[model samples]
Target: MTPPHATPVGPDLPMPFTHAGVDQLVSIWLAQLDVIRDLAEELTAEQWAAASPCPGWSAGDVVAHVLALESELHGAPLTDHEPDWAALPHITSDFGRLTERAVDWYRTKGQDVVVAELIEITAWRRDDLAHAWNADSDPNEVVTGPLGLELPRERLIRTRILDTWVHEQDIRTAIGIPGGLRSDAAWVCAGQFAFGLPYVWGKKAAAPIGATLDLTVTGPGVSFERLVQINENGRAEFIERTATPATVSLTLDWPTYAAASAGRLNSDSTGALVANSCRGDDQLAARLMPALAVTP
Candidate 1:
C-alpha cells in the first residue's frame, strides 16, 4: 500500500518525448557515456571515493561498474579476477558480483586510471555504434546485457541507456554536481520507467480487475500522463483512455518520482511526496503510487 502522506498536491501539465526509437536510444547511450565521463573528469580524489546513493558503492565504484560492463562488451580482460564478495550482502546477483569484482580491481589501480579507461571505452563505443546501428536490423535479436542476462538487442540497449543515465545521477548526487535532469538521458530514463506502471499497479498493488488509474508526472521541462486499467483479461494494461473517469490520479514533479522509483526516497519521504501530489481517492492513490516503482 502507498503510505499515507501529508503533501500530495501539484499542477497539471503536458508530457512530450523529443527523442525515441532504437537508433535514437543507442545515440542517447553514447551521449550519456560522455556525460558520465565528463562528470568523472571533474571529480577530486576524495569525491571519487565518496559513497554514492547506491548502497556500499562509491562514486568511483559506480564509474568502474560502467567501465567493467563496457569492457565486457568489448571483450577486454578483467585481469586476475578474484571473487571476494561472499561477505558483501548486496552482491547477490551475478551482475552485482561482476561489477564488484571489476570495481575492486579498478580501485587498486586508482581513480585516474579508471577515469581514463572510461573515456577510452566510451570513445570506442561511440565510434563503433555510429557504424553498427542499423534501423533495419532486428531489434529482437538476443544479446548479452551488462548483467549477463540475455535480452533483445533493443531492450538491452535501452537498459544500458537507463543504467548509464542513472549512474550519472548517482555520481552527481554523491559529489553535489547535479545537472543532467534536462538531458535526453533523463527523459529516456523517466519514460522507460513510466512504461512499467501497469505491472506495478496491477500485480504489486493488486488493484481490482477493471480498475482505472491516471498519473501525471511533471519534471523539469517535462509533463506526461499515463492511464493504467485492468482489462477483462484481469491484466493491468496501459491504455490510451478510459471510457469512464479515472478511479484515481497522481501528480508530482520528476525528482520525487525518480528518487522514489530508485529506492532513494524512504517510505516516509515517499509518503510525504505522495501526499503533496495525489488528487482523488487518497486511499486508492496511496495503494497504487508506491507500487509504481518496479526497477531493480
Candidate 2:
C-alpha cells in the first residue's frame, strides 16, 4: 500500500484544477498571499529594500509587482507613470519597463504604504476568485493571460499559482526568511515543472529514441518522481510506468529544481544542487541544463 502522505504521479493523480476543481488553484494562490502578508507584516524597512533573487527587483519591488498584477486582474487601472525605457539596460521589453516603473513608484511610497497595499489587494483578489469560480463559471473557458494570449481559465490559475509561489520564495531568499517549502503552493509550483519535461527532453535535450530520463524531487512536504521517454515518433512523452531502465537519473530538492526551471538560478548554483548519473551520456546531461529552464 502507498504511504498515507504520498501524492501519486500519473493517471491516478487528479488533474490539477479538475477533480478537486478550480478551488484547488485558488486555495494555493491564497495560501501564498498569506505567506507574503505575514512576511510583509514582519519585514523591517531595511529588509524590504534589499535586492531579491530576481535581478533588478528588491523585495519591496516584488511585492509591488504582485500588487500591480492583482490590480490589473481586478480591472483597476495601472498608475499613469511612463518610465524612460532607454535608460534601463536590464529591461529588455516594453512590459519589463512597465513593471519596473510600478516597482519604482512603490519604492518611493516607503515600506508601510507598499505592505498595506499588498494586504488590501491580495484580500480583494481572494474574494474575486471565490466569486468568479462559483456560479457556473467554466474552468476551461479561454481567458487572457499576462502575455495577452487566450488560455484555459484553469491553466491560467495554475500559472498564477506557480508565479506567486516563486516570487514568495524570491522574497524569502532576499530577506533571509526561508520557510514555505512544505506548503501546497510549493508543490503546485513543482508540479508545473513536470509539464515542461516533454519539451526539455525531446526538443531541447534531443534524447535518442527509446532513451528514458528520470527525475526525483524531494522537499519537506512533497516528493515526486517523473519519467520521460523518447518514442518511435521522435517525440518525448511522460510515462506512468516504464520498465526500461533510465539512461539518466537526476536527484534534487524541489526548491533548487523550481529555481532552475524558472531560470532564476544560475548554472553553477544548479550544478551544485543536482546529484546525477548521466550513465555514459555526459554530453546529454550537460544538454539538460539549458532545457531545465522552461519559464521566461
lDDT, candidate 2, 1-296, per-residue tens: 11234553442353233343677667777778777888878888788888898887889888888877777787776677766667657788666776687777776788898888888988898888888775356888998765355899878887888888888888888998877776777666766787788899889889899877887766555567788889899889887656666877776676777777888877776555443523436667777866798776
Worst 10 residues of 1 by lDDT: 1-10
State the lDDT at 212 in candidate 1. Answer: 78
The whole-model lDDT of each prediction reads 0.74, 0.74
TM-score of 2: 0.88
Best by TM-score, which number? 2
Q: Can you write out model 1's per-residue Cα lDDT over 191-244, one digit (the tens) per residue?
A: 677777888778877888878778776665334677888888889887775467
Worst 10 residues of 2 by lDDT: 11-20
lDDT of 1 at 162: 78
Q: After superposition, how far is residue 157 of candidate 1 from its true place, in Å?
A: 1.4
